[model samples]
Target: MSEDLIDEDEGPKKRVLSNSQVLGFVMRLWLRRPVLLAAAVGLMLVAIGFDLALPHAARMLVDAVTAGPANADAAWAAWALFVGVYLAFTVIRNIAFRFWNPLASRNMKELTDEAFKKVQSFSADWHADNFAGATVRKLTRAMWGYDQVSDAVVLWLGPAFLVLFGLSVMMILRWPAVGLFSLLAVTAYVATTLLMNKYYTRPANLKSVALDSRIGGALADAVSSNPTVRAFGAEAREEARIAEVSDAWRAAALKTWTRFMDVGLIQNVLLVILQAGLTGLLLRQWQAGRASPGDVAFAITSFMLMSGYLRNVGENIRMLQRGLDDVEDVANFARQAPQVRDVAGARPFAGELGEIVFDKVTFRYKSADEPIYQDFSLRIRPGERVALVGPTGAGKSTFVKLIQRLYDVQGGRILIDAQDIAHVDQGSLRRAIAVVPQDPALFHRTIAENIGYARPEATLAEIELAARRARAHEFIARLPRGYETLVGERGVKLSGGERQRVAIARAFLADAPILVLDEATSSLDVETERQVQAAMEELMVGRTTIVIAHRLSTIRSADRILVFDDGRIVEEGRHAELVGRGGAYARLHAVTQGAAE
Candidate 1:
């Protein structure tokens, strides 16, 4: 939601992934069901062989008819056998397709799921440096490309290869010169396809996809912050920017397709030349009585089939390149190493020691020029109530985040109950601490569901109790659907105060040993804040609590007040002591009092 989180500057262009990497990505999915893949391949090969043999059957029927009217029975029998073979392989081909499609579909689902999980696992730095829209678009396109490439390899290109091989063999058996010519034409088509794809389609398609992602990111960035855009009257500018990018995308697409068209034209011309030459040669041979009528028919069928096959080869190669281009974006994103990961042999945190110690910690945000905290050490005793009073960007939120292991410290250790967090399982470490941020985001779900999010297994009665404690139950009960009312995206259907109450209820439901109140009541009205304050007071009875607040009035009862300035604890004492001392905390508190008056 922060402007800093939207990375607008386009970095260096992404290089297309190697064909081998793309193939490896595709092939790895087959490893999941090797038997199915093998069966499919075997069946496909047999089917392709039978399909190619149909042309030979035609040749055989022509030869049988040309032999004499006495061989009519033989011709009819041959035709019947050909029909039976065709029907058999059609059944086999359908079965092979049935098995292969599921494998491809399942593979695609797994890949997309893995990428989504990986994105969620990524550190704050990775997210902050990437655009959410661009990342999502890349993942979507990558998944689609994965599906296309898988289908092309297993369904299109795979069969094409077998068909071509079988056709070549059949041609050679009929005429050695024709077989060699067909093979040469195929070889040339493939070479041209590879060269053209490498130099033209790959780069062009990559540019096109890149532009599309940028447009997607830009559109999302503009639309998500609709309130800001509308308030600032920047709608026209946003639309113009989108149009510019979209036009560029169109141009890029056209360039790639135009190159494909050129390649197609070249292929068509080459095929025509090959066809003409082969047909003329066959006719001359037939005139000299060196070739039979069957040979002529076979030559025509083979050339027609080879022409289409060669065209498809070009198309498949382009598809492979396009797939590689699309996946390259997501692969780059997934390759980002998570900054915080569970250490080897790490154990889940247990118990409620409720003690947190920052031992000579050093930390800085990725985008910041200087460390927010360096050689900073602090200790909060079990059930201690500490208030962190600081100006914006004084490292208050960062401290809480580090304690929860949302981001690890750059140097030194953050220990919970004397156990180093970095050495413990992240999930367990977070489980011990519950955070209620200033702007708590809620999913679009029922009020009860949102409140029970932290403890998914909590019963309705338990949820209602937590809501009552947070002063949220009465309002929820008043809604038409009561607790079942749908909170629209980010809980926008609810007022700020209601959303805050739901967040408080969620925290109450969590009941963790340590609590972080990051200006939790900042959005509530004075009356609601008072009620929530009472609830928080009750919840804090036996928990180690860290309260980050700018409003000094809220922390009057805190046992100790820490005044942070420039990442250092400039002043620390009880609220009354700091007020009497007339130091940093006293000055900050005075500003709040003055502003209130």
Candidate 2:
């Protein structure tokens, strides 16, 4: 797998959380449903009490049988008690799970929802550096990992250790030596498992989990760009690349599994020592007449109880460790606050005037060596139409980004309608600005849903009006499903120009005070481009509009044309005035004109 896709040192993983923090994250969710948690814990205690009683009941039954023929009634009574205790334990344990299962499932549901919402809230730069496929893998894996951890904590960890300790104490009260051995043996077994899982198997498991995320990311990257691969006939290349990642995953996973198996050998050896030593100690007591046959029976039964719980404890330790490792990334995500966040007591974006101002704004991308804008000041009055012209990476797109508050400036501030954008609710601020990108992205939903996304409350009649205005209603009406048609992932089912028109319709529905178009007609054919162009002119009316264009002719009629070079405005004028001056805009126009001819 590519290091860029899943490297923990980069992007979101820069704030890696420890295992304990992950455990706490899971605990907080469990703590939310206190009633169910209490019920589960109480039932577990009841089940353990019944389990401990079984061995004592076995002693009474054995003694009753060995007493005499007259003791038959006594034997029958003890036998019934034994079976009843066993039955109660089985039923109670299952009932406890009934409580536990729902508690776990609900937490899983909330965890996934919270994780997705956080991912959505991340800054654009964060999303740019992370992989969608990898993020999905972590979120889904964390859910199951959470379930595993909760299961061990409620079912195995709580009951296994408690039952083992009770059995040990019970044995020690009768024969101090035998009880002491049982206690030490089980303690040593649990301790060894924890140490081995923590120090040995954990590292390997973490590597395997990371590789798993990478495989998901690699597959998503390839499949999402499958059309491009087909066009270039690179299916074989993609196959080989995926195979390389799969092979790495296989190696890491195999190593981790074998380490677990290796650790199991130690647990089996410890159980054997406990079994042999306990039975041997009982035989010594019997030979000295200090222990009866019933005592022997009790000792054997206690060892059996110890054996089962000891095994579960070892497995539970490994499971808990692995679960925590899988959950680490998501817990970190929760702890690492979003880079772009609303201020405390932030108000909604104010005013409908569509006035934008950049006051001495100094900004740079985290990954860039130099600032994009330094002490930059600009103002666009309400209802002004401004065109930005610049080469790639000359800060044209960033100008619009700053207006939308996608990234905050390191120095100074941006204001929308006299309100500092950083001091406003991001949702309200964005709702007042509509953006149409050069390459528009749409959901795999009905065309109506996609257009209505900008304004969820829009009625079908309103959607149709917007689509017709954007010249999209005619093509959409011809589809078999009309407005209800599903536009595949990212609108792949529609042509490029059709997708752009749908995007335009969405923007039209937004009805925001400020409009931004990033080469909106870049995808359309000449005829449709002209139609949408005229429609866009109408859409620009009464709105503060900023257009970024490479085709100089498209913005020739802009109220003001600002030619950006590096981070400064090198030329500011209308098309004729700028062309006559022969500056940066003039050279671009000359180049464009030569290419067209």
Candidate 3:
């Protein structure tokens, strides 16, 4: 991987999202499954209602018993009502979870799918700029973060708030002083937690999360480059690098967790104050003969309920913070607009004639100080075989990418069969052209799958035919499981020549009107290249072909050869004419005569 590709720049990292933003994002997903969400939420409300009936029932029972043995039946009825309410609450909460669990899981899956789709839609350069492993870590972590967020909202915070509100209302209706104290304590506790978390804990937690992502990226980078590590005997150096990152994460995580404990301690003290104040208020009311024993019992029961609910709320708040931190990465991903976007109402590219035209085009990379191509124009007629001859960093690859509309030109239009590529759907445009890159990377799948990837609907017979046409079937036949053999990651199990042939076979299977050969045979040996070149000659007969020639001698038979330097076409002619003219192409041929031939 290039140094520029691993963009783990921490200084300009993503901003942290607020609770509402995170929850609102989740709620939007829930709205998609309206019935399930409604059922779950409705059940939670019913459960809270049943649970709130208990303290009132306790009050009723105390009053009934205080009226003496004449009220024994009423006392028993109150006790029975309380137990029934308790059981009802338990059942409804369980039912709520049944609905909530599936909804959470489904939404997590959908969120992941949506994030992956957005990442895929990002430009090739955007992908190069980000760490692949870090992106994976964010996607996976955010999925679980959403699960925690959903749990905090539906299971803990929602019920806790409802219980607090209901209990506080009942207290206010019976004992004003106690109710006011309870409300004040809760408000103070929540405020303190929010303030401390925002100022003290959040920075540490965010840093730890960033380092954790770096660790994932580091591991992926090292492991993927294991061959290089072993060749250079840099195992210890790699371990030290990992330890350095891991140690930073450890310190940050410790500080973040300790900050939570600090906040927890303060909230617990406030809880104690709340309990003491309520007890003192109840005693004063009773001593003044202004409150009955039943009222005192209700006060005690409500205090217990409020205390437990408040504690739960405090814990849920902490969980919510952790979830918010984790989800911030993916949320930012959604916020960043894609570098390349299709025009509105873009039509599918309908192609049978492969005539390609670049008319008055101008293009430059964002990082580049100068434009790569300015007002550059060219046209390749249908069934023409055109070869681009140039040193690297010239406009050859960009030319191919432009035709596929990978990056939109700043000015002018690129067209295929007279249809403007920028105005066509990307997938449809790319499907009309087949590209075999210089360094062909394959998925870790069977040879058959690799070849069939170009056309998933291709039959086994069709795959074999394509493979034979590209001279890949001979070596594949010698493999242990033939087409069923799994190529290791990026086809590491195969030689470079083998991978290149497989790529060519895939192009053969594509059956597109246009074909791009980006140094296609550069990986092959002399004998293999001869065989593959023979096959390519047959394949190029009826298609408009663009070859980014690595070996200049190989393109002598092209209908026309273009010599490129910097960003412009310096010379254009047949091979003999250009050689006889003793210009740029002839100079290039003379310089590389031994190696190119």
**Top TM-score prediction, candidate number:** 2
Most lDDT-accurate candidate = 2
Report the lDDT tens digits of candidate 1 across residue range 328-365.
Answer: 66665555567778889999997596898989999987
Candidate 1 segments exceeding 4 Å error: 1-16
lDDT of each: 0.81, 0.89, 0.85
Which runs of model 3 end up more than 4 angstroms from their true locations? Answer: 1-16, 62-72, 594-597
For model 2, residues 36-149, the per-residue Cα lDDT tens digits are 999999999999999999888998999999998799999999999999999999999899889988898899999999999999999998888888998899999999899889
Following a full C-alpha superposition, what root-mean-square deviation does model 3 have from the true structure?
A: 3.4
Task: Specify the poorest-scoring 10-residue window by lDDT in model 1.
Answer: 1-10
Model 3: how far is 444 from its true place, Å? 1.3
lDDT of 2: 0.89
Per-residue error (Å), model 3, residue 3: 28
| Candidate 1 structure lDDT | 0.81
In candidate 3, residue 207 scores what lDDT?
Answer: 75
What is the TM-score of each predicted model, taking all chains together? 0.94, 0.97, 0.94
TM-score: model 3 vs. ground truth? 0.94
